[model samples]
Structures are given as structure tokens and as C-alpha cells.
Target: MTTLTTKLIQQSDARGSALAVISDDLSLTWRELCDFSLRCSTMLRDKGIEKGDRVALLCSNRPAFLVAWFGLANIGAVTVSLNTGLVGEGLRYSVTQCSAKAVMIERAILDAKRADLEPVLEGRTVIVFDGEQDLFAVLSGLAADAPYEGLGSDPLSIIYTSGTTGLPKGVLNCHEAFLASGRWMSRYLKITEADRIMVFLPLFHTNPQMYAVMSALEVGCTLVIRPKFSVSNFFDDARRFDCTMFTYVGTVLSMLTSRIKTPDRNHKLTRCVGGGCPAEVWRAMQERFGIDPHELYGMTEVGGWVTGNSAENYRFGSCGKARPDVDVQVFDPQDNPVPAGTPGEIVVRPKAPFTILLGYWDNPKATWESSRNFWFHTGDAGTLDQDGYLYFLGRLKEIIRRGGENISPFEIETALLDHPDIADAAVVAVPDPIFGEEIKAVVVAKRDFPPQDVRHFLEGRVAQFMLPRYVQFVDEIPRTETQKIQRRQLQENDRGMIDLQGVEEHA
Candidate 1:
């Protein structure tokens, strides 16, 4: 009874109850979902996938992702979900990192990136999700019934890092680790059979699948899936599916609020869940969109969600309190615990009854580094208040050390977003001879507003040094498929693209 797996939740659903998942053209219930997953698991096992094997899913958000996540978890096989948006080099990097035994991809998607993927998964099995060589043809024809052998602590996934920093490294999380994440999230979110969570973020990312689907399944909550997040159809999707809760991030909320009209202002969602909400936007978004913005802090390496802004009980700028079973502390350089309100590295240890990830896949150095002192160093800098509310202060690597001042880009970006003409802003440090690094802001201006207007809007609101030297406007900031701005990329690109002559000339 202590052990947890997706099959247990699948079996918990009533015979004819509604538990839905939506792909582009298909929507299915719990009964059908379980059956489909069982069949898929059988086919995969028959194809020599055993306990602890990594099976890469290279398809986009689809019904197959839901089925594959459960089916793999059911049989103790690891599900490595790869983002389909990864192109030539990026696609190759992920596949190579995963070192998966097989990949389940859509033909159209695979065809587009064949040159890159062909070599990476060369000897491995390549099962298509759509077209002639579809997984349905192979899995459906197999015997539907198979003895499920679930491995408790064996690896459940080797999710590759987003490669925003450099190259993507595979983060290995075990079955028990995922089980704990799901259970804790269920408790934190107060998920119940009455709750119908809507998911639109890519399944490849841990948030949507682990926090959204797995957490819902654990509580027997109905799932409303979307292939991709659509700003135009978001509310309509929620209303159509009767979703009580939806997972969100900064960009998703930004997109939702950007439009002139919010059709379903008092929409169905009770709370829009996930992290990275600016404090200024949080109140306005709640007032305008009619949903409580619940924030959570997470990384792919450390299972799914670590902490979340609890519903009903809210914190202004903090992500939230840690789960009852999570051991969290803010530590300085030598790993000594820091005082409240002091920014330090966030470390987490598995509390009793829950499991922690073993390490990063095939990268012993990273594994050792991340797992030092029996704590998972999250590489994020944050402060915990006296009341235990954890305020996120961006990633440690993303923080800019400028003119003896440690500036949080998140603070600058949040400030810029307050501007009327700016739709979104990303701040990164560009090379500066004087201050060591200079602040440069790349903004996505509102369609109606020009770059000059946005630059003028932020002139006096922020400090002279804190203000971005270069304000470059683009149609859209380069972002991961998950909508996180790739700041490292922006920083690298800014060297050539931005004009840093004036502001740093004083420095």
C-alpha cells in the first residue's frame, strides 16, 4: 500500500466515469484511457521494453502522451517525453542525451527533423504516432491483457534539460520520486474527484504531465487536455471541458491578459496553477480573468513541483510554502543555512515516506553536484520569510552581477512588464568592459505600441543603473516550447544585436 504507480489510480476510477484527455482530434474517458494505456504497455513490453528502460516520446501534446505516461509508469518503464518543437541541432541534442531504447514520434514531426533524429536514434526503435507506421497499428494489434510488473524505485524517466544554459542533460527520476511528487501535489492543490484540471502546456515538460495529469489521476480528478495552449480558445476550451483548475506559467498568463477582451472573465477555472507570476500582474490577472493564480516552484531534475502558492491562502510575491514532506532550506556558498529574507540556493531533501531522484542520467559530475550533502541543490536563489513563504529570486545563473550590484533580471523584467506598451520583457546581462556585465532588456511590445514608446515608458520608473542600457524590441522573445524565455540565448545574441555604448560609457 505504501508503493504508488499510475495503474493504482487507473484502477481507482469507476467503471463508466468521465476522465477525459483531448488531442487534436480525439477525446477519451478514464475507461478508454486505461484500456488504451494497458494495450500500449503490452505492445511496448512485447517489444522488449523491461522495467527501468527509458522510452522516449517525441510527439507533441496528444492523447498518446497521456496513454504513454501511464502505460510506462504502470510497467516500470521510464517515459522520456521530448519536445517536438526542437529543431535540427536541438532535436539531436535531446535524443542523444536521452539515450532511449526507442522513440514514439509523429510522422510529420519526425519527417521535418529526420536528418537530425535519424542519426541520434539510429539503432533505436522509431515508432511513429501518426501515419502508416503509427503506434496504433502496432500496439492495438497486440494482446490487450498483460501482467503489469511495476518497479517501485526504478527510473521512471530521463527528461532532458531544456538546454537553455548549454546542452540538455538527462535528469533521471525514479518511480517513487514521481509518485511522491504526484501525491504531494494532490494534497497541495486539494485535487479531488470534483476537480477537473485542464492541461494545455506541453506534456514533454514535467509541469503539465506530472503536476496536471498524474496529480489529477491520483485524486480521481477528471482531466481536460489541450494539444497546445491557444490564447484565443483558452477560455472556450475551459468552458467546453468544464475545467475547474488549469495549469499556468508567466507567458500563458501574459498571453491570456494581452488580448483586448477576456470572453469568459468569470471563467470556469477556480485557480490557475503554476509558477513565475509577477506580483504586479498577479492581482490584475486575478481581477480581470476571474481565477486565483496559484504559483509553484519546480524543475525537471527534482521530480515535478516542490512548492506551490496554496489556494485560498495566498502570498504576494512568493511561490509558496514547501510541501509538508519536503525538506527545504536557503543556503549560502558553503551550504550554511541563511537567515530569513536572505537570498540563497534552495535545497530540498525527501522527507519520510517520499522518494528522491537518484541522480542525473549518465552525468556523474552533475549528479554529485546536485545531490551534495543529501540535498538537491535547485540552482535557484530565493528567500524564505519568517512565516515560511518562499520568495523566488530567479535562477542563480540568471542573476546579473553588475557594478558590485547583484541584480535580479526577474525584478527588472517584472518592472518593464508594468509599462503600458510592453507586452513582455526579458532582461539579460551583456558583456561590458567597465561593470563586467551590463543590463539589456529585450521587450515584446504590444502590437499597437512601438519600441520608442516602450523605451520612453520605462525611463523614470526604474533606477538609472538598474534601467536597461539597450531596449531592443522584437516581435516575440525567443522562448522554450514551455514559454520560458531563453535568457542565455538572449544574452549571447545581445552581444551582437544590442547597442551598449551609452549607459556603460559612464561605467
Candidate 2:
């Protein structure tokens, strides 16, 4: 029955002047945070926004975004968090797709997309966070207290997916689902009120919003916010903000590991919880920073994490066992459970009601398709061991098919990453006349390593058929905001590729 407003109010009363949120130039205590959210809610209500109305927030990782989010929750309105990096048609589509009644945005963002946003802003309330029409001024004129009477089933937020494959789908999450996710993550990460967490991932993402922001709020912990992840200033920020815990994705971890070690690398960080930590980089990062790495597995549609590795029970390269409240299984194309140590699609079923996503916003077809056969199909390929640990493979669609054999790109990518010279690698499927699709590896290396050396390195490790037929060196690999590889982009940019085995070109 607990709602975000009730939880925040209770935490404010309990924690009072305790630090709640910290950014580069701004910090707020629990009481202050609650007051700001109340004012924001009042402002929204004053602008004719009613309960269940959609309010779009297009700000970066700052206090303004948090205030807007909680404000929407307080009024029982749905918060549509748009990506700050999105512009033009993408930005317009997101705002319109959700039918947002109002939009609270930074003035800088508005100015940048004034032409595109003008058409979308018609008949909607637009409040700028900066300049002459500052949103803070409106809040300052309003009272600093409001009441919330919302059910746990009330819709809280609509978080859009990365849209790598096509247009982003808005994932609708209810209050109960959001709260349950935070509670689960807090337990998984062993988060406490005394902990201070660093959150540098974009707020538009579910990882930072659900795991870092919500977990901290649920436990009355302090959240140190950064605009975005910066490898150069990560350690410094963690130390400066006295962060005891932080979350990361694989790409950020790789970038951090590639950076030269400095004397100021020491920090108060004790725990790191995130997904996509490569097995090779896990131990090296822990040894270098003295922080425990806890890998997890989940998607935006799952509400939160379905599986996670903990300090008490952790296995290298495994995403840990399925959470007790969730039924996670690997299923074949026919929806039958696969045997242990076999790769298949990962599916999940929630044991508790309202603990997973309500559905895709305004897209019943997608919702029904994902929840077919009474289970949520994740579209990811992975294997479950006899010990119940889940090992994540690449996406099912991304799996490379060679001469009548199914090949996992993740397996080959992991092998390539094990090489000392390679920093990051992505294996993609390229068109082949005979094999249908062949393997093309796009790599980012620390130094110049000949393609022949890469082939030799993979000779004894992977099967001859699984080795990439073509290799291309790039300065950087293209990735989405969430750090997932953009294999489609690599395929589109594969003009000049080095053939390792003198493979014939496809017609």
C-alpha cells in the first residue's frame, strides 16, 4: 500500500536534515528534498495537470530531474523521462507517443531543439528549468507541502527503451513495481541508510533510476549524482562525495580499466553492483580498486533485477541464481524449458502481482507478444548451470550463424577480450553467400595488433568454424546510451574489412 509520496514523506520525517541528494553544485537534505517535490507537485497541479496525466521530464542527472519525478509521483501522474541525448524526430516522437500533457525541460535543451519541439509543445504546459522562465521560480511561489492519495497499482513512470532496433517502446511501471524493484535491489546490494551511492548513468535509464535512486530513497541513503560517467573523474568524484557504493555497466568498467592508474585511485568505495562486467576485467578491477563486483541480470521490462550475484554467494562470469520472487527459466523456441548448461531464450514470470511492468505504453501488441504463453520473453540468449547460476550470452538475434552452426557472439567476444592487446570487441553477423551469415569482428585495441595475430590467438581457443572470418579495427565501438553494443551500426559501416582466411565476398 506504500506509495512513493508516502515513503518520501516518512523518510523526510525520520531523516530530517540528513543528506539525501548531492550533485556537482547542489545538495539537499531529506526535508529539503521533500519540500522541493511538494512545490513541484503544486506547480504541476496549478498548470491544470491532473492525476494520471503524463508529464515529460527532459533533464540530465541533476536535482531538477529527481524533483520532477517525485513531483509527478506525488500527484499520481505518470512521469515520462525522455533521454537528454535525443533530439529532432526522436525527441518529438517520444513526447508525442506518450501523449504527455505537460513537459518540464531544461532551457538549454529547449533552445537546442526549439524548432522541433515547438510543434510538439502546442496545447501542452512547458516549464523550463533555466533562464527567464525558470521552473524553480514557479515552485518558490507555491506552498511546500502537498498530499498524495494513490494506490500501489497507480502508474508511476514510463521508461523508454534504447530503441536500438527500432523506435523506443515505453515501458509502463506501476508504483508497486517500482517500489518492489528498489526493495529487491537494496537487499541484493546490501544497501543501508549509512551508505552513499554514486550515480553517473543517465537518469533516463532504468538502472540508475530503479537501482541507485529508488534504492537510496527507500533506505534514506545519500545519492551523489553526476551528469554522466566520466572515466577521468570517476574515482575523484567517488572519493570527493564519500561514495561507499556505485553501479556500472560493462562499457564504463572497460573504459575505467583502460585508463592509466593514478596515485589518487584509492577511495572509500566498498561495493560495485552492475551488469555486464566482463569475467576478465572483474578480478582486475577488484584488485586495482579494492571494491567487490556484484554482477546482475535484468531488463527494463522486468521492472528490476531477476538475478544477481552477492558477496555471500558469487561465481565469476555468472549473473547468479534467479531471485526467489521471480521464476526465471531458459526456454527453447517451443517454450519448453531447456536442460542445464544449454543456451536458450531467458523467460521470466513474476510470483507476486504488480511486481513487473504493467505493459508497454500504448502498445498492446508488444505487451501481448512479450507476455505470450504466460511468461515474459526476454529475447536474450543464456544458459543455466546445474548449480542454478545463469550465464548470459548475446542477444538471440545477434547470434552469428556460420556453415550450418549456431555461434554465440558473446563467447567469441569474451575470448577476444581475454587478449592483452584488445580493449573491447563486438562480433557481428555479416552476409555470406554460402553460410547465410558469417562472423565479422569489430575490435578496439590498446595497440596495433595484426589481424593474423588475432587469428592465431583464437586458433587454439575457439573452434575453427567459430573464429571470425573478417576483423576490423576501430578507434571506438558504437554503443547505445545504456552501453549495449550497436551491432547494426557496425554492420552498416563494414566497408573495408580485413579478411583473415581469404574469404570470398558475398554477392
Best by TM-score: 2
Candidate 2 Cα errors over 4 Å, as ranges = 131-137, 261-265, 503-507
Model 1 accuracy (lDDT, Cα): 0.74
Q: Model 1: how far is 355 from its true place, Å? A: 3.4
Candidate 1: count the clashes: 1
lDDT of each: 0.74, 0.85
Residues 88-147, candidate 1, lDDT per residue (tens digit)? 888776766766888877777888888877778778887666732365566668766454
Query: Could you estimate the TM-score for every candidate?
Result: 0.90, 0.95
